[model samples]
Target chain A: MNRKTLHVVFNSLFGIGGFCNAILFPIVLETQPDSLAQLLKAPVNFLRQRLWWLWPASFLLAALAKFADKKICDRWGHDAVKEMLEILREKGFPGNKEPVHFHRVTLFKHKRWWLCWRFWPWSGWLVPVVRSGHTTLNHQTCFLAPDEADHAEGIAGRCWSTKAVILIPTEDSNMTLPLLNPEVNAKPHDPHAMAEIYAKETFMDTDWVLKKLPHSRSFLGIPVVVQGQPWGVIVVDSRATKIQCAKGILASYEEIARPFIKCLERLS
Target chain B: MTTAPWIQVEPSLRMRSEPRQGLQLTLFVPPHEVPQAVRGEFDKQLKKFVIEIRYLDDEDFKRETMDDTVCLRIGKNSRRLLGIELDTANLNVAQVQFQLKEVEEEIKRAVTKFLQKDQAQEERENYALAIKAIESKGEQLLNRSILAPAL
Candidate 1:
């Protein structure tokens, strides 16, 4: 279970345990030999002798309860994301022609190089926990997959850092040599060299998203927040760049993310 | 055919696809900006490297390049510009290629600014910076590089 859920369960147990002991203290004192020392001594002896098993039992029950809640919330949270993606689909991801995928990306520390004995050394990735599209890879596997953007890399990471919506093709490339231009044949020059140069110029700087489906031109990443801290981002991608690049469209995508905040807090 | 022994001397040349020390090399951002992605890729296929640019001017930047070496400057007025340069002493010009996507984007931005309603003065200058980024870089690449006389 995540820290927030564990915190709530522990706090509840503490409150209940304290309240019960406080109320029962005076009643128990009246029944016992009437002294502060006697009151403390009686329960200690009784608990040690008769109810020793309850302490371990209570802890076992709390862990089991947390395990169950995690399953239920994970299902519920994914369903919420699926629903939001449907809404985004109907809206055509604000403005685009082809399929636009929506994914719930969360940050988690995973093991790095298990061969080395130093432990998973401070590696974190913003991975897709749940996704909306023609789902191919299992969500759980994607969690451990290397393709997930490192917290310090990719469009998802940038959104988490900037705390603002990021739209790609952020600026223009200014060089236009025939050698650099793909259309203008830099023939007599090597074909391999020509393609590499064009690709360098074409590859977008803002996105580090993996398995980027072809024709997915525009990328929109919104920071998915939980418990007042930035948790991850919801990535939305589409084929059209111009329409999806507007402010109104970006704001609309941000609105879609609001409904799922509750679900995020509960599951992860 | 019988070869002359005196003409049999082999050329000692080591060529590498120039690593893009271009805008793609910034540690804070991803490559296509820095050629680390392209750097790891060099061993995979025997492809030419993105030319590395060493700008003659540290600030604002006067830039130069040649046929064997291609140099193009990248970035906005306030941002640090990355220039492209190639090593041509070894590899035939058969392999070198220059990246142009940023140049295309700049052109698009310039056109957009030209069409916008609020741009007679400052926008005109903004439009010009975008154009000059394309023009000067293109002009540098267009003119063939002149090497100084080897004494």
Candidate 2:
């Protein structure tokens, strides 16, 4: 059986066993202390006393399954993105001077009640579930890895919020990529125009999107939609800038969303 | 009719639908301009030709339908022409090739109409480049079915 089916079976069995034990185990030990003593004498219960650890261990397995699911999603996302990049190159996509990097910044909504204990908010953060690495760049330096973007911040977040494609180019050079609070405003499409461009989103800066790697001056974020809801943004970053404005190259990479969502639903 | 070196068009089969074997006609421009494609079932090519001049969000520009299939994207604030959306679903793109010249003329006319609305320097330049791209690539789309390769 599939892992999911196995998990469901295990859960149902565990639920029934736990319910029976919740009442029977305590009652049996209370009325017949000798039975409890005999059970404790078993070799398996040597360290765990009454062997109550089994209950918590079962729950631990379920938690681990969740963590594993995230890892699996990441692995799948990475493969799909890499394959997509390859397709673009083969199809003669007019790309950038520097190697272009694409990331799937998914909105991970912490829906489960158990997830409340996590540091994440109920609304969830726009985390880079699938990240790509290159020779000149490291995955950690991207706005993902260590710190994810808030649902209302950055080009990716804004795309999610507006459900639109947000393109911030370098040749026009508007954003500061500010690591700090909002600062600077410029005319039309200058470095300071971030204030006007990001009038709704206060954190419209990216000076430190790459703390260690080379700066990503141009950004094109496309909102990924599935079943009429916003899922995430396909973030394309170019080191040489001008991915959109003033030539350099305007690619039709927007269709990457097609293969992306396809892989998501395929169960592959 | 040729595009400037700065503005380029690299045509690629950006998306192929499921079902493995079916005819899909994409009189396509390279897939730039829009942020993404709304995933849907397109058994036959959507019978549309979309040339997104600038990549834009839905709110960035307001789409004004010139006709049932022909539409122009106008910037929300600048009011300049942004792009063209033509629904060619019923139109046949085949080897017989009778409609190529007519289709090209219609496209040129539509673009000219959009450019005439605004005479700004930026609009003028955009008009030139867009025409060049259409002229250069419109022929490749003219005589053959975009799905010829698959066939």
DockQ of each: 0.01, 0.03
TM-score of each: 0.37, 0.36
Question: Can you write out model 1's per-residue Cα lDDT over A173-236, one digit (the tens) per residue?
Answer: 2333223223443455654554444334333221212223133444555554443344666555
Model 1 residue B117 distance off true place after TM-score fit, in angstroms: 37
Per-residue lDDT of candidate 2, residues A1-268 (tens digit):
6656655665665565565456544553455344466755454344245537655654565555555555453355557765664544333324324344432222222121213222344444455544444433322222221133343555565555544445554223344332222232132244344333333332334333222222444455555544333445555554433343311122434535455555654322
Q: What tens digits encode model 1's per-residue C-alpha lDDT throughout B94-148?
A: 2234234443343344345433523333422323332334343443432222121
CAPRI accuracy category, model 1: incorrect
Clashes of 1: 17
TM-score, candidate number 2:
0.36
Chain B TM-score for all candidates, comma-separated: 0.20, 0.46
